[model samples]
Target: MRHRVSGSRLNMPHSQRVALMKNLARELFEHGTIVTTVTKAKELRPFVESIITRAKKATTITQELGTKSTGSPEAMELKSRNLALRREINRNFNDRKLVKKICDEVAVKYLTRNGGYTRIVKLGMRRGDASEMAVLQLVDSEEKKETK
Candidate 1:
């Protein structure tokens, strides 16, 4: 009767699972890339994408909100949206700077694109645990460009 569970439990309790996800996401956002077990990457993919999607929405709203008066209702609405998203993101990320980075820079980069903000590349297995490993990372990176 495990149907429709929607996500891997990773054999962890709810709080540990949430902590693992938050830490993985924070590292991924701060470094723009991370290598972990394939199972974990698969799980983190959608989680990271949702955050990027939120960022994209903020970017779109800000772009469409240009020239509005700061005190105007429209401007206030946009500000509220920004604050709300920030607060939502802050739940996963303890550092305010990382949250700002995602909203201001990372999200803005993917504005033209629809989705697929993160990419996962299989990196073979870990020697000790024999777990299938992979690199889960942001798509747009200067280092990725240089490697190309």
Candidate 2:
């Protein structure tokens, strides 16, 4: 019966599922890594990746334009494009500071790479329910490794 349906419902209603994802994403952004159910981690991977891509795009636009915030028509156009990307991301995330951090810092770190922003590591099973658990984390950028 369930042939082409995409995405797990997680046995939750639509609103709750969205809220759960939002909370998980917020925590993941703040801490860099989170331990969660395997199922949740799988679902969160694509969601987080897409957001990072958008943030990366915004960062890219700003970088390409550099300090040219005004004057030229091209600069204005790029600025608008960057603003639109940020606004789209802001719609999903509640905290402005978090959104800023994503665009300015997190995305910048991954600008050199393409996709594969997150990694999910299996952590065996939870004792209470025996559900499979995993650690979802952002992949470390090469720049950070060189600095350390």
Worst 10 residues of 2 by lDDT: 62-71
lDDT of 1 by residue, 36-127 (tens): 99999999999999998887787777776787877889888998897787778887886789888998999987887788889999999899
Runs off by more than 4 Å, candidate 2: 67-69, 143-148
lDDT (tens digit, per residue) of candidate 2 on 1-148: 7899989999999999988888899899999999999999999999999999999999989888896757899899999999999998888886789999999999988988889999999999899999999999999988778999
Model 2 compared with the native: what TM-score? Answer: 0.93
> lDDT of model 2 at residue 99?
93
Give per-model TM-scores: 0.90, 0.93
Q: Pick the candidate with the highest TM-score.
A: 2
- The parts of candidate 1 lying over 4 Å away from their true place are 141-148
lDDT of 1 at 105: 92
